[model samples]
Target: MTVTLSDEARQYIGAFEEETEATAVDCLVDDEFDRLVFVVKAGEMPKAIGEGGETVQHLEEEFGRDVELVEDAPTAEGFVANALSPAAVYNVTISEMGEEDETVAYAEVAHEDRGVAIGKEGRNIKAAKELAKRHFDIDDIQLT
Candidate 1:
C-alpha cells in the first residue's frame, strides 16, 4: 500500500531529518494525541535520539509538540515490538482474526510494564494500532 502524506507531514519529515540527521521511514501526525510519531529507519535510532535524547527534546521545544520515536521494523511482529518500546514487551503474536480480513496482535508485555504499555487513556496502544495499520496492515493490538 502507498501512503500519501500531507503537506504538513512532509514538511515535518524534512525538518526532522535536517534537525537530527537521522533518516525517517515515515512520520505520523497524531492530532488527537497532540503529538508527532516519527518512524525512524532501523539502525539509526540512537542517531535520531542523539546523546541523552537532546535531539528529540529540541524537536519537542521547537515544534511545541510531543515527539515519539519508533524504530522501523522489517516485519509485522518486529514493528509491533518496536511500537511498544519502553514497555518491555516479551513477544508479539500475530494471528488472523475471523473472516473479515482482520489481523490482531497479541503482545505479551511484562506484568510490571502493563500500564506503561497501555499508556494513560490507552494512547500507546492506540498509536501502535494506528501505526500497525499504516505500515503493516495490522488491524488491532491486544495486550495479553
Candidate 2:
C-alpha cells in the first residue's frame, strides 16, 4: 500500500528552507496506532534533524504527534548491516564447506562484548545463531 503525509506535515517540511532538496514525510497507520516517519537522504540527516534534534522535537511538540526521522540508504541490506552493532561485529565472513554443502559464517565480535556474544547460559548466543541461520542461511556461527 502507498503512504502519504497530511497537509499539516507538509507545513513542517517547508519550514526547513535551509534544506535544499525536498525530504519525504509519511504518515503510517498500523494495527496498533498511527505514527509519522520522515525519510531523508543519507547525507541530509543532520540538516533534517537540525542541531540536537531540535527540528524534529519542535515539530513533534507543535503537532502533538510522534515523529521518527530515518535516513534512507541505497540498499536495504546495507541499511540493515549499518544499523546492526558495528563495534560488536567488526567483520563477518561466510563460506561453504564439506560435501554436504553446509554454510559456515564467522563473526568477529569485540573483546568487550565477549560475554554478551556468549550470553548468560548461552541463551543469547543461541538466539543469535538461530536468527543468523534464518536470515543469512548460515548453518554454523563462530564468534571470535
Candidate 3:
C-alpha cells in the first residue's frame, strides 16, 4: 500500500533525511504523543540514529519533540516485530478473520516484556497499530 503523508510529515521527513543522511520510508506525526516517528529503510537505522544517538537527539532538539525510529521491513510480520521494538518478539502471525475478514497481526512477545510492548499508556501498541494499517492494511495488532 502507498502511504500518504501530510505536509507537516513530509517536511519532517525532509529534515530527518538531511540530518541523518538516511532514507526514511514514512513519518508519523503523533501530536497526541508529542513525538515524531520515522520509519527508516532497513539496515539504515544505525546511520539514522548516529553514534551515541547524537543524531536523534539533535533532531529532537531541532523539532522540539521526541523522535522515534522504526526500521522498515519487507514483510508484515517483520514490520510488526520491528514496530514493537525493545520487546523480545518471538513470532508474528498475520491472519484475516471474522465475517469482514479483517487483517490482524498477532505478535508473540516475551511474557516479561509485555509492559514495554504495550508502552506507557499504550502508546507503543497504538503506534504499531497505526503503522501496520498504513503500510500493510492490517486492521489491528494483538500481543500474545
Candidate 4:
C-alpha cells in the first residue's frame, strides 16, 4: 500500500528536502504511538544515510519525532533478521540463567564488536527483549 504522511511529517519532509537537497516521496505516521516513518524511492541506503546519517539526525531534531526511513528493496539479511527476531538470533550466546531468573547472553564477536550487537546504550537488546516477549512470551533477554 502507498504510504501516507501527516501534515507535520510533510513539513519535516519539506524541511529535509530543503536542507539536504534530497527528494523524499512518501511518509507514514503511527498516530497512536506518535512515530514517523519515511520511505525513499532512492535505492541506496548509504545515500539515504548521507554523511554519517547527519541528514536524518537533523530532521529528527527538527521534527522532534522518531523518524525511520526504509528503502523499498528487499534485502536477504534484513528479511532474515526481521522474520526471526525473538526466535532466531545472531552472534549471541545464552550464557546463564540466573537464580533471579534473568538470563545473560554474550555476543560471539570480538570485544570491539559488542556494541554493534548490543546497540547504543543497550537499546538494541531492549528491542530484542520486546520482540521476544511478543513472539515467545519471555520476560527477559540480556546481551553482553
Candidate 5:
C-alpha cells in the first residue's frame, strides 16, 4: 500500500531530510500525543539522531512535538524488530493469516520489555502496526 502524506506531513519530512541529511523512508504523525515518528534509511540512524541525540532533540524543538526514530530494515522480520527497538525481542515469526488478506507478525519480546514494546497508551505498538501495514503489509503485531 502506498502511504500518502498530507501537505503538512510532507513539509515536515522535507525539513527533516534537509536538517538531518538522512534519507527518511516514512513518517507518522501522532496527533493525539503530539508526536512524530520517522523511519530513516538503514545504517543511517546514527547520522539521523546525531551525536548524543542532538538531531532528534533539534527536530523535536523545531516541530514542537516529541520525535521518534526507527531504523529501516530489509526484511519483514527485521523491520518488525526495528519497530520495537529498545525492547528486547527474542524472535519475530512471520505467517500468513488465512482469515484475511493480511500477514501477522508474532513478536516474542522479553518479559521485562513487554510494557515498553507496547508504549504508553499503546502509542508505540500503534505506530508499529501502522508502519508495518504500510511498508510491509503486516496486519498485526502481537507481543508474545
Candidate 6:
C-alpha cells in the first residue's frame, strides 16, 4: 500500500533515518498518545534501537515526546505481531468476516503478557489496528 504521510510525519521519518541510519517506511504522529510511532524497515530494528536502546532514547528526547517503533513485516500476521511488541504473540490469523468482508486479525497472545499487549488505555492495540489498516487493509484486531 502507498501510505500517505503528513509533512510533519515525513520530517520525523527523515530525522529518524538520519539519526539511526535505518530506513523508516512510515510514521504516525499519534497526538492522542502524545507520541511518535515509526515503522522502520524489517531488519533494521536493532540499528534503529541502537545499543542498549540509546538511539531511541535520544530520538525521544529530541522529539520531546515518547517514540515507539514497529518493524515492518511482509505479511499482515507478522506486522501485527511486530506492532504489539513487548508482548508474546503466539500466532495471528487474518480472516474476512460478514457481508462487508471486513478483515480482522485474531492474535493469540501469551496470557501472561495480555496486559502488555493491550497496553495502558489500549494504546498498543490501537496502534496495531491503525498500522494494520494502513498497510494490510485489516479492519480490526482481536486478542484470542
Tens digits of per-residue lDDT for model 3, 1-144: 999999999999999999999999999999999999999999999999999999999999999999999999999999999999989999999999999999999999999999999999999999999999999999999999
Model 4, runs deviating above 4 Å: 1-6, 74-144
Reference-based TM-score, model 1:
0.96
lDDT of 5 by residue, 38-78 (tens): 98999989989999999999999999999999998888899
TM-score on alpha carbons, each prediction:
0.96, 0.43, 0.99, 0.44, 0.95, 0.98
Tens-digit lDDT track of model 1 for 1-144: 555688899999999999999998788898888999999999999989989999999999998999999999999899998999889989999999798978999999999998988889988988889899999889999999
Worst lDDT run of 10 residues, candidate 5, spans: 1-10
**Model 3 segments beyond 4 Å from truth?**
none
Candidates sorted by TM-score, best first? 3, 6, 1, 5, 4, 2
| Error of model 3, residue 11, in angstroms | 0.1
Tens digit per residue, CA lDDT, model 4, 1-144 = 233456876986777667666566655554544555554545544665579888778777877776656443243233223322323346544433658665433433445554654655654455444433333334554433
Every model: Cα RMSD to truth: 1.0, 9.0, 0.5, 8.9, 1.1, 0.6
Clashes of each: 0, 0, 0, 0, 0, 0
Deviation in Å, model 4, residue 9 alpha carbon:
3.6
How does residue 26 of candidate 6 score in lDDT? 94
Poorest 10 consecutive residues of model 6 by lDDT? 28-37
Q: Candidate 6 on 1-144: residue-level lDDT in tens? A: 889999999999999999999999999899998999999999999999999999999999999999999999999999999999889999999999999999999999999999999999999999999999999999999999
Candidate 3 TM-score, true structure as reference: 0.99
Off by over 4 Å in 5: none
Tell me how candidate 4 scores on lDDT: 0.51
For model 2, residues 1-144, the per-residue Cα lDDT tens digits are 223455765665565333434365332222132335455556877776778878777766765666555444454333222223323667666678999998766667779976766755654455444434434455776776
* TM-score winner, 1 or 5: 1
